[model samples]
Target: MRGSEWVPGVQAAASYEARWLPKDVMAGLVLTTLLVPQGMAYAELAGLPAITGLYTSILCLVAYAIFGPSKVLVLGPDSALGPMIAAVVVPIVLADGDPGKAVALASVLALLVGLFMTVAAVAKLGFVADLLSHPTQLGYINGLAVTIFIGQLPKLFGFSVEGEGLFADVKGFVTGLGDTVPAALAIGGGGLAVILVLQRFLPKVPGILVAVVGAIGAVTLLSLDDVDVVGPLPQGFPPFTIPIVTLGELGMLAAAAVGITLVSVTDTISTASTFAARAGQEVRGNQEMAGIGAANLAAGLFQGFPVSTSGSRTAVAAASGAKTQVTGLVGAVAITLMLVLVPGLLKDMPQPMLAAVVIAASIGLLDIPGMVRLWKQRRIEFALATAAFFGVAVLGVLPGIAVAVALSVLNVFRRAWWPYRTVLAKPAGVDGYHDVAQYPDGAHIGGLVIFRFDAPLIFANARTFREEIRRLAQAGPKWIVIAAEPITDVDTTAADMLEELDEELNAKGISLVFAELKHPVKEKIDRYELTRTIDPAHFYPSLDDAVAAYGQRERDSA
Candidate 1:
């Protein structure tokens, strides 16, 4: 690949014009407003210090700006990935009783995820993301939203809850409700309300920044010692760090790494495709994998955890009229400046307010409207979505995602295993064969039946195909003409089934013929020598020709 092709930042820079500079600068500023609060909130959500969130944000932005394919995609610590990070790292943290060790483990996980993504990009395995179908993706995200919301409720109420899973978390919150600090609750609730109002009525405003600043002001003026705050942040750029872990922990980390890679790549591609569509740009999935891989690699090396493309932040940038990756670079620079000049800007920001920030973001992840649409449009898909929701809600994040992937793959096989098959006949005033059940008035030739099987003849459905053929033959038709246009391929098992069916039909004094057989399918039959067992002349290029030949044979016999 050429330099321009591999490095999207170089391409963006070459095409840079003065006209876009002002817009990009403004977009960057607007993005920083959300990035700062979100970075910290998600970092804490991930079982890491709030400062690491800022580190992840800065490094990922700069790295993606240099490598990402999309002009507007904003990479950062994501609400969705936070709980997953926590799920994987929190247990290790408890085991070691050291927060630093947990952070190191997460960094190593990020590195592994980055390597997985990079390897996939190099191998052109972008289609691996397709393992999660649309329905499964919706279910997983909705479940994640519920999990995050429940998981953060304890923090939002100004208390910590100990739990093993989503249900336990909810139970812990309910039981500990009496222990919640009134001051903390008031500050957190008020902050959340302000943020929600700003988002609903004044979307263009920087709601998170306003809410955080207001909470800080309230804490200062009232001397609210009861409310938990983030306290002072370490001042300076993120230090270069190497993630260290024991060899025994490598297998566990590898499993977590796979989950992170799946979620990160899927989210990145979906987000990139969405923004690209709006901008009239084509999405390169493989390139995006490489780009996000580079960003994660940077984060892992810079005291950060795994990061993903953030839909909310990306929308902020796009809505603010960002023109290029320069927007991300500007945001990175702005964040670095804040760390240098005002590292303690959010020192008095309440923990509940941060929880509110994260909870609000997670709320956006729920697709209730999407679920409704699915219900109205496709009930089976809605069911699949519901199953995925329960999978995550009950089984926990990692296992739930695994179940979703399994369901997605099974859905594909389920369709192939029992695909639609129908008897076809020439309908009145119709030019071609139609399903006899759907078109009851259609006429079948005196001694011929036209059957249509609407899927490929693969191993899974081969027996079904053979059985259906036998059943249609029992209808007493002297000849069976298969409308094979829908049959794309005939696997070895299906070929053997076909050969056996041919012999059985011949023994019953019925001849089997195939019409509109695709060339590739015909070649498979020929290769299997099934064409010799039945007559090679039984194949026809069109249904009409097959019927015509059958009619001529009947007339010659009469």
Candidate 2:
């Protein structure tokens, strides 16, 4: 068995060297600085108590270090998953009126998500992550950023707004602006400004840590009473427990679990693939699914919620020269030490400052430049992205995700439903056949037409293919050669259509020929008896050979 197969963690540890220790230690320290604030921030974002973020962060890091395939991936409470968790958990908590029950429900949700991911890994269904295309993903995230930003605005101003959904939150925020506490607004605004400036001018500086510490100090020294703070946290390591929920709520929890699983796996694979590429390493998507599943499972059992790979945290580790999963291990240990030793250190930390942390992270999530590039390069994809953006921003997170997924599936069918087809001709100075639409000056051999269809022959597009072929035949060519290199598959419906087209052509004194047909596709056609109906001799190895044969047949007829 391979080292990774025998023991996943051993692959990183076995190659460890003393020289890499210092960088890993430093990276670990840096990661802890970010993890501490972001964890609590995202936890509250998920409608849980702030301390759960630390629990989620610590457990996920340690779990991922052991089972995760990537050397540098950082697993924790992510801003992207925050609202999603809140959307599912908060409603149940409000209905039950029990905080403990809410935590259990969140844990159950995480456990379900982990199990789904594990099943996907076992089934090698990593390709499901590609259900959302690049543009759709971009738009969904941008929409998420907007959603998160709007949700956090009232918190930043030290006011509570009770509302459901994105628009309702927006409405609450707008009306609640009058109730904002000046101290909270100042701290949140100042912290956000400092983070942005430091990131812009001195990126190597631990800007978030600096901003968080500064806010804490200001709140303490100023004795700020009006500002909302994180208050005191329970000081200890996370205890293990199995989540219990009523059987009646299982169906609702399962739906939420599926949503979380979809987003988490897709986010983890994309982040891992990117960092793995930068490190000149390959990413095992299925393994990543299992690793993230293991991490979420550990978190759920430890009184934490579902977690996913954090691209920002992973980037921090990579930039700080992390060498292995030891970075994550060290970071987890550091957070544990803080929880045990300095649980009250952030007691005066303003809640708005935490809100600022989330806002800063959300800002990074909006890929405006990427959206612009998409708009300029591919207009239709841009439209798809726009649709997803509106779907999330207007419809709410869960509904938006459903809309994005539907759009992705529809985009696939839309392309196949009316795929590109063209006539092929040899340009005077070119050696091979080119699309006549693109090369209008190209020559078409007399009494023959070379046609090309640019997609697999599937049930969806079978009729369209037949119609196009019929239209082309109306030109009354004695021979029609299909440039079949692009037709990768011929399904049962398509094969049947081809057989019918062949017979019709033969009855009209025309021969249907296939050129550049792939072996598998030809085999499929032969299995359907198309070869017998159309004559096996009519197949040619290349478009040029088919053209030569057409020339010989014309000479013989003359």
Candidate 3:
């Protein structure tokens, strides 16, 4: 029972209600319908055999059921990860053109990613999931969506395009346009239309499942020999086996694993947070990381690849009234039964139909509305998002992730480097001093400057602070009183600058005072002995107190 804190599924089972059993069973069956086609589709998308997707789905679901904290979050192979996986494994396998080697490399990559995620969870590093900022993440995903849609174009039209990056893929698609098979195009186009229409109008119907069934039926009835079918799947459940790779390949796979783990953790945490809020459950972030790690590890061990939380699948399960992890377990069992008893069930399913499934999923991944909102609200953030998008479109998927992360980090530094600084003035009928830019008619006392610097006094912006103060000093004010409420920190470089600036000002018959400086920053000032050079009496607890003191000093002098 004590260990149940770590193993949440055990706790859930202990408190299981009888009424939930039927709901879980039904939801699991419904979930399986959507899972089968998607699993096969995403597997092909990842440059692996379609059957491996089922193995990944089964293993990840079962493992997540045991270790996952969220009751409704679903773990599986994802459309977003497909290209990333292919980017890593395809180049390596291109030399030998062995499907077996590709699978092994991908599995090893999954194992490494799982290990990294598990270690991070233990270290309580769940906050690292925010590696991708919202704007940059939006751009990267949009770029990825476009790349995937183009990559799948040749497949959707019944030909194969072999190229890297967006431009090359587009060119290959164009060059191979003459080889397009009409039957494949019609079936694939019709399948995509069916899914889009059903999903748009009839939300409850499993559109992917319907499209798959219809395509298979059409192929079988019409004897469509021009189309490419999935053929028979390997029989039985995935066997437990350790994926191995050479020492030379280990480093490259590990690098890919880091990117995969980052994306997986981000996706899982966000998905879990959304579903948990709807379910009225708290998000245990660290526990969720462990759950994701366990699922990936399990999949990697069983001839499968890395996976993440699937928002679409979870939505389906929740809509169907899933009550517990039992739903996921049920889905896993059903997939296992299908593999063992009906291995050739989807043998007649057309490859173009699979492309349609992936293309539809890719379309969903785009956030056009979100991109438009970013552009309208904040142009700088829109630029960041656009840069991230181009990073993926111009460079490869892996490099694009690098670009997004770099841009996010640089954006943070950019803010801190030149944060907003303004002059504050007390306006008529206002409670306190406000930005003078917003109150041009605000009153101002002679020989007093109420300046505000809206950032920490770090080394990055110390020069900027010095220049702003010097610029204000040229007006010949007797005192410059900083509205310090927003100045959260006073580093050593800033303290030194303050001492020098105060001395320089005093030499010019002007003084510097601080009001509403936070206690922590004051403590740092004292630690740096800044008060020895600058007067301690100049420090005031609030803006009002500083103004009163200034007025009193002037009256006494008069």
Candidate 4:
């Protein structure tokens, strides 16, 4: 725990001052009011009891208030990370119908994740989260969204159906169509409709909350206890207890830990960064990690599942003029009070309405505007986006996330396989050699063909570079100059291949020249005696210098 924290060791976050006006007390209430039901809905999405979400929301805020770097960001139970937790927990619970055992396993998993994140924070390894690129993340989220919607359909329709995968769930749902409770269905459908319509028209109207309340009121007035309520959630102050897990359960929970750690850290850090960016405040990635790390650990202790940065709720806090982490503290206190005293109020809340809230939230994450922007800027990126979108929508979440990740890896390989290599030429008034395509009919310095490879020289595309050089050399070019500015590092295989090419060029009396080599790359060449193999004089700082030197050498040879 950071010593500067107001709450001592319990606190997981650090603090920063807002240069402008700080967040007001009313703004905190506005965000809290929005978050109370959302936390429950997201908890249901995570395959945990509704109250676990409430516990997470409260504890995370308290933890973040103590340790959070950003004042405007709110930490809570997030729908985005829900599918991942469900994917991990459902299989385990299906095998053993013990809800207590499932909770135990999850608590242990959450604790481990907290420790992992805290360690990562101390090490300043926050950037490791970026290993999964944006494209892959998009695909993962898309897939999860579809998976969640499919899984929640039964709850939405007020039917009890069981299936492991999306297709199986859909099939089971169809088979059990007759069991749908009409009242629950009405609440679900109406809640979804109202939520969506309000989001579109009334931005600050608290649509989800209103829909939930309306659904509850409708269910109560119409006497629909025949349709299920979430039941009196295990409410009151969180009891302090250490998570205990057997070795077998721990082993089973490892994969969940991996998935949760990634999702939790990604959401938390991104939300913090987004809030900080909007407020023109500096963000500390390590501090954010520590905040989230403590939140997860606190949640685990409080019998809550894993928690993360809630994007929608964070935006709410930011928009509500939350100037400091105290807003989160206030929100936590508010939720705690709701859980302790008003537990009976939520006893008859409809499951379908919760499902509807989740559905409404998840659908909005599709990012239509972002896709449009990407489509106009880069068609290839747009294609990747479409692939992820459909892949999640149709194929399901697990497979969709898998496809997105695979696509990202493949994208990297594709660029490496056919890296941008351009032939350079000197234009009429340009300072040095530039890409011929970029210049208007630029001259090639009288038989000197200069080529620039824009990526690192490695085994993946070294052959292509070699082949192009040989072809250009054979095109009656007396000298071949490589503009090595963008080419950073070279592998041993590339160096060996270059050596072989150098011998071939020497025999044909065609000079191989290199210009503008980065110091690191130049050092590699020097270490390998590449400069000895090819004359040291051939190397120059500028393309013009190389061309002039080559021309002078030609004149001397003549």
* Each model's lDDT: 0.90, 0.90, 0.92, 0.77
Q: Judged by lDDT, which candidate is best?
A: 3
Indicate the worst ten consecutive residues by lDDT in candidate 3. Answer: 1-10
Residue lDDT tens for model 4, 1-558: 455642432432232444432454666778777777888888888788787788778787887777666667778777777776777677778778777665666667678778888888888888857755676666567656666777788889998787666688889889988998888898999999999999899988988878878988887888988677888866688787687776777875675676677767776677677767877877787778887888888888987777788788877776777767767877887777877888787787899989898888778766656767777988787778678766666665545555666677778877887899889777898776678789959876677888898888989888998998888887877788899998889989899988999999998878888999888998998898887678888889987788778878779989
Alpha-carbon runs more than 4 Å astray in model 1? none
Candidate 2, lDDT over the whole model: 0.90
Q: If ranked by TM-score, best first, what sequence of candidates would result? A: 3, 1, 2, 4
CA lDDT, candidate 1, residue 338: 93
Model 2 agreement with the true structure over 314-374: per-residue lDDT tens digits: 9899999999989999999999999899999888889999999999989989999999999
Error of 3 at 327 (Å): 1.1
Please state every model's RMSD to the true fold in angstroms: 1.2, 1.4, 1.2, 3.1
After superposition, the stretches of candidate 4 with alpha carbons farther than 4 Å from their true spots are 1-24, 372-376, 386-403, 428-431
Tens-digit per-residue lDDT, 1-558, candidate 3: 145677888888889999999999999999999889999999999999999999999999999998999999998999989999999899989976776898898899889988998899888899887879999999999999999999999999999977889999999999999999999999999999999999999999989889999999999999999999999999999999898888988998888888888888888888998988887889999899889999989999999998988989999999999999899999999999999999999899899999999999999999999999998999999999999999999988999988988999899889999999999898999989999899999999998999999999999999999999999999999889999999999888888899999999999988899999999989899899998888999999999999999899889999
15 Cα displacement, candidate 3 (Å): 1.2
Evaluate model 3: give its TM-score: 0.98
